[model samples]
Target: MKAVLERKSEEALNNNSSIWRNKQFLLLIWGTSVSNLTFSIFTMALPIMIYELTRSAFAMGTMRAIEFLPNLLLAVFIGVLVDRFNRKKVLLSSVGLQMVMILTIIVLLLTSQLQLWHLYVLGFILYTSAYMFGNAYHSVLPLIVDKEQLTSANSVISFLYTFVGLIGPALAGMVLLVLNNIYGLTITAFGLLVLLLFISLLKLPFIKKEEDQKKTSMIEEMKEGWYSLIENKELWNLTIMVLLSNITSAATLSVFIFFALDVMNVIETKLGIILASTAIGGLVAATVAKKMTRWFTRGQLFIWSLAIQSLGYFLLFFSLDWYWLVAGMFCNGLSGGLMNIHYFTLRQETTPNHLLGRVAGTSSMLMKLAVPFAFFGVGALAEFIPVHFIFLGSAIGTALIIVYLIRTPVVYMR
Candidate 1:
C-alpha cells in the first residue's frame, strides 16, 4: 500500500511544473555551485603554481594525473559506499574532508613547507574524497528532482557552474598576480566552508533498497552495478562516446598551457582570462540548452555537441593569437556545457535508482581511466615535439572519434 502511494506521488511530481521551488534541489545546486566556483580558482592556480615552483610541464601534468588516477582505482568502491550508506552523510563528510585538505594546504603554503611531493600526496587524497562526493552527488539528484524536471534542474545547475567558471579563472588570475597562490587558496577554502553548511541544510528524500540486495558482498554489488551500466544500450553508447572524447581532450589540454607559454608567450596572470573565456561559451550554452534540446532530437544534439568540441580543438592547432585561441575554447565550452546537462538528464531519466551511483561512478571511471595516460603521454611527447603539433594530433584524434560516433548510430538521443 505504501509502495503504491509512493509511485503515485512520484508520478504527480513528474508531471508538476514547479520543480524550481524544490528546496532540496535548490540547495543541492547551491552546494555544487559554491564548490565549483572555488575549485575553479584553486585548481587553476595549483597548476600554475606548480609550474612556477618547478617549471616542469611534466610535473603539472602529473598533478592532473593525480587528480584523475583515483577514478581508475577507487571508482568501484565509491559507488558501493554511496549506495550502502546515508548519501547525505557521506556527501557532507566528503566536503568536510576536502575543506580540511584545502585549509591544510593553505597552512603549508604560508609556512613555506609546501613542495611538489606535498601537492602530489594532497591531490591524491583530495581527489579521492571528491570522487566519493561526486557519486553521492549524482545519486542525490534523481532522489530530489522529478524525472521530468531533470532538464530544468540541470540547466540551472549547468548555468551556475559555467557562469562561475567564466568568472572564476579570471578572478583567480588577478588574485594570483596581486597577492599570491596562498592568498587565492585562502579564499577558495572559505567557499568550501560555506558549501559545507549548505549541504547540511539540504532535505533529501530517503531512497530504500531491498534487504536481500543489501546483504550481498561488496564485490557482487559492484558487479551488479557494472553489468547494469554496460547492458543499457543508451548508457553504454554515451559512456563510450565520453571515454573516447576524454582521451583526446586530456592529451590536448595537458600541453595547452605549455603551448601558450612556449609559442604564444602568454603571461601567467593573463592566462586566467584566457581560461575564463571557455566559460563564457559554456555559460551561454547552458542558458540556451533547454530551448535547444526542445528543438533538436536527443541523438542529433549529442552528435552535434561532440562535433563542436572537435571543431573547437582542431582550430587550436594553429591559434597563436590569443583571440583565435579564445574563439576555439568558446566552441569547445559551448558543446561541453550542452552535453553535460543533457547527459545528466538522460542518465537520471533512464537508469534505475539502485544502480544510479554505480553506473555514474563506473561511467566516470571508464571515461577518465585513459586520461592520466594521455596527460603523461602528452607531457612526455611535448619534450620532443612542438606542443602545437601535439594539439593537431589531438584534433585529428577527436575528429576520428566524432566520425565513429556519428556512423555508429547513437542510441541515446531523445
Candidate 2:
C-alpha cells in the first residue's frame, strides 16, 4: 500500500514539473486544437456534401479513396522531405496549401458552379496537404516534451482531438443548416476560421533537426528510415499491429453511414448525435489514459483496448437499434482514443529524433495502405452482403489481431 501511494506521488510530481508547464507545449496544443477542429469539420462536411451532390455511395467511397490515396503514395516521399528540409517550413507550406484548397472549395460552392469532379480534385489536394502537415506534427511532438511525460503529453493531445471530434461534427451539421438558411454564409465563415488558425500557427517557433553524422540522398534517407523497421524486430512487429488496427478502423468507418441510415433507419441529425456520442466517450477515455497507463503496461493497454473494440464491433453486428449502435460506437471510440495515445507515445519514445519524420510517414503509409482496400471492399460488399456481416467480419478480423498480439511480445517495449 505504501509503495503504491509513493508511486502515485511520483507520477503526480512528474506531471507537474516544468516540462509540462512549458509555454511551447501550450501553444502547440492550442494550434493543434484549432487545426483539429477545422479538419474534423471538413471531414464530416465533405462526405455529406458528396452524398448530397452525387447521392451515390460508390461516389462517396471513391472520394474517400482519393483522400487516402495521398497517404499511400506520398507519405514516404513526404517523410523523406520532412527529414531533409526544415520541419517547420514543411508544416507551414502544407497548412498554406490546405488554406488555398479550402478557399477554392468555398468559392466554387458559392458560385453554384461546383461540380463533382471539382470536389474530387480539391479533396485530393486537401488530404495531400494534410498528410504532409500531420507527419511533421507527429514527428515534432517528442522534441517538445520529456520522455517521462510522453504518455501524459500524448493523452492531452488525444484529449483535444476527442474534444474537437465531439464538437466539430455537430457544429458542421449546424453550419450546413445555417448555410441553407442564410444562403451560403456558413461556408465563408468556416473558411475564415481556418485562415485564422493558419495565421495563429505562424507564431510557433521553427523546430530544427539535430545535426546528423552523415547527410544522404533522398533515396538513401528513405532507405535508412526503412532500415529502422527492417532491422528492429520490435518496431516491425508494432508496425504490423498498427497496420492491422488501421484496417479494422477503416473498414468500420467506411460502412458506418450505411449502417446508420439503412439498418438503424436514423435521421441525419441523429446520426450526428450518434457520432458525437463516440467522441464524448473518446474524450473521457483520453482524459483518463495517463492515469490508466500508470496501472497498465502499454502493451497491456493496447491489447485490452483492442479486445474491447472488437467486442464493440461484435455488438454492432447484433444490435440494429439506434441506441445499441450508439453504445457500440461509443465503446469503439473509447478504445480507439486509448490506443492512439499509447501507440503515439510508444513511437515517440522508441524512435530516433533524426529519423522521426521518415519513421512517422512510413508508418502512416503502411497503416493507410489498407484504407483504400477497406473503402472499396465495403462499397462492394454492401451491394451484395448484408451490412451487418461486414461489421461481423471486421470484428472477427480485429479479434484475430488481438490474438496475434497476445502471442507476441511487441507491446513490451518502452
Candidate 3:
C-alpha cells in the first residue's frame, strides 16, 4: 500500500513539473510539427496523384495496402531496434531515408519519368520509415517529458496534427488546382528537407539497454511485446477499440475518391478541401482537450467523444454540398481529437519503458492488420453496392463498439 502511494506521489510530481521549460521537448515538438507538415501534405497529395492517373478505386486501395504492408512487416523489427538502440539515431535515420526517397520522387517528376509503380515503391518506403520513426518517437517521449504532462503534450501534438490537416490538405487542394503533380511533390520534398534540418538539432535523454537485453533473441523480444499488450486488459481493450474503429472507417473511406468525384461531383482540384474539412473538428477538440480532459475521466471523454463524432456521419456520408460536408468533418474531427489524446497517452502511461516500443509495434501491427482488408473489401464491394451504403455499415460497427464499451469496465477505468 505504501509502495503504491509512493509511486502515485512520484507520478504526481512528474506531471506537475514544467515540461514547458525543457528545450529538448520544445525542439522535438517543433521538429515533429515540420515532419508532420511534410507527411500531411504528402498524404493528401498521394491519393489525388494516383486517382487522377488511374481513376481506379482498386489502385488507391492497393497503394494504401502497400503502405500499411511495410508498416505491418517492419513494425516488430523496428520496435526491437528502438528498445535496443539510441532512439535519436533511429529517428534521424528514418527521417533521412524518407527525405532521400521523397527527393528521388521529385527528380523523377521533374524529369517526366514518374510512373504509377514509382509511387507504389516510394509510398511503401515512406510509410515504413514513418512507422520506424513513430515507434522510436513514442518510446522517447516518456524519457524526456514528465509522465503527468504526457496528456498535455499529446494534446498539443494532436493539435499540431489537426492544424496541419486543416492547412495542409487545403493547401494541397489549392496547389493542385493551380499547379501540377510535380509542384505538389516538389513542395513535399522541400518540407522534408526542412525536417532534416530540424531533426539534426533534436535530442533526447539516454536510456540504457541491459546486457541481457542485448542477448535476448529477436523472436523473444517480439514475443515480449505481444505479452505486454495482450495480458493487460486496458491495453487489449484500447487495441480492440482502434482495430474495430479502423476496420469500419476503412470500409467507408476506401472509395472516398469515387465518393467525392462521382457521388458529390466535387472537382478534382477541390478534393483537398474535402480532405481538409475533417481536420477542422480535430483542431477545435485539440484546442480545448487539455482543459476538457481535466473536467472528465478519460473514460467519460472517450465515450462522449465517440458519441459526438458518430453524430457527424449523418452529414459526412449523406451531405452532397461542400458546406455540409465541412460540418460533418468538424464533428468527425472533434471525436478524433479526443480519441487520439486518450488513446496514445493511455498506452504510454501503462506500458513499461523498456517494452514501450515492442508493445506499440505489436499492437499497431495487429490493430492495423484489419485496415488493408477493409480497404480492399470496400473497394471491391463498391463495385456491387452503391458507395453511400458503406457508411451504414460503418455506423453500425461504431455502435456495436460503443455498446461493448458501455457494458464493460473500459469506460470506468481512470
lDDT of each: 0.80, 0.75, 0.77
Question: Per-residue lDDT for 167-186 in model 2, tens only?
Answer: 77667677666665123334
**Candidate 2 wrongly placed segments (more than 4 Å):** 1-20, 39-61, 105-118, 179-214, 264-270, 382-386
State the lDDT of candidate 1 residue by residue for 1-414, as single tens digits.
346437635754664667666777878888788878878778788898689789999999789767767789899889888878888999999999888888888888889888888888888889999889888888888777766677877888888877776677677777778977877888888888888888999876655666654588889889988998888777687888888888887887888887777789888766766777788888888888888866788788888888888788877887858777877778878888888888888888888877788888888888878877787788898899778887678678777777777766463456
Which candidate number would show the highest lDDT if scored against the true structure?
Answer: 1
- Model 1 misplaced regions, further than 4 Å: 1-16, 39-62, 103-119, 173-189, 211-213, 258-274, 318-322, 379-392, 407-412
On residues 1-414, what C-alpha lDDT tens digit does candidate 3 reach at each position? Answer: 344435544644654476566555777778777767656667777888789779999999788678767667888888988887778888888888888888887788788787899999988888888889888888877766667788877877888877875676566777778877667767777776676676678755444555544687899989988898888887788788878887876776777668878888888557766667677677777778778866798888877877775666666667768766667666777877788788889899898878899998888887888887787778999999888777767766777888878776678887
Clashing pairs in 1: 298-413, 298-414, 299-413
Number of the candidate with higher lDDT, 1 or 3: 1
Q: Which candidate, 1 or 2, would have the higher lDDT against the true structure? A: 1
Weakest ten-residue segment in model 1 by summed lDDT? 1-10
Stronger candidate by lDDT (2 vs 3): 3
